[model samples]
Target: MRVKSEIWIRAYLRRCQAEGVPAVVVRRGDEAAGAIFICVDRLDGSVALYGPAPAGIEGGETERRWVACFKTATASGAEVSAYLARQSRFDSDLWIIEIEDKQGRHFLGEDAIIE
Candidate 1:
């Protein structure tokens, strides 16, 4: 069984805080099983977005995998916002977490697939 979305999110927030990184939930969704989307604001003009990896990606069954949304390493804030807006419309239950860091650190560890 997978951990509840709310539980996972809370733990993630705590982890970020422990690392002295400023992170917050920009949008709340279902507490049970909502997909999570992370927005990494580099504190510059560029931003990076990470969303739940699609089915069949190789990873632990209970682990959450993420995929970068943009083809480039980073994209403009407007571009990411527009893509997120479309995603929000498509999945209202999805959760959004925003991390503001000058270094653009997402803190997703090895679960993130950039390519």
Candidate 2:
């Protein structure tokens, strides 16, 4: 069985703190099975959003890593924020994590993160 969503998120936050990277849960979702979205704040007025990897097609590879879903140009932080806001409206159960790191290091678990 898969781990609970809240448990996974808490562990992720702890890892971020241990790494000395500022991370916050912008929005909390269902404790058991909410989808997770991560926003990496590059600290340069730009942000990148990563979502859970998509499922594989028939006969395709099943294992996948987090995938980049959105990116804002330099100095477009507002745009990224607005985009996230819209997403929240659409999916209230989605968990949003904002990581403030110049290098955009989300540390989303190496085995499950491709980039």
- The candidate maximizing lDDT is 1
Q: Best candidate, TM-score-wise?
A: 1
Model 2 / residue 32 / CA error / Å: 0.6
Off by over 4 Å in 2: 57-64, 71-75, 111-115
Q: In model 1, where is the ten-residue run with the lowest total lDDT?
A: 54-63
In model 1, what is the error at residue 3, expressed in angstroms? Answer: 1.2
TM-scores of the models, in the order given: 0.95, 0.78
| Local lDDT at 13 for model 1 | 97
For residues 1-115, could you state the per-residue lDDT of candidate 1 as single tens digits? 6788899999999989998999999999999999999999998888999999998877546889999999998999999899989998999999999999898888899999999
lDDT agreement with native, every candidate:
0.91, 0.74
Model 1 alpha-carbon drift over 4 Å, by segment: none
Question: All predictions: root-mean-square deviation over Cα?
Answer: 1.0, 3.5
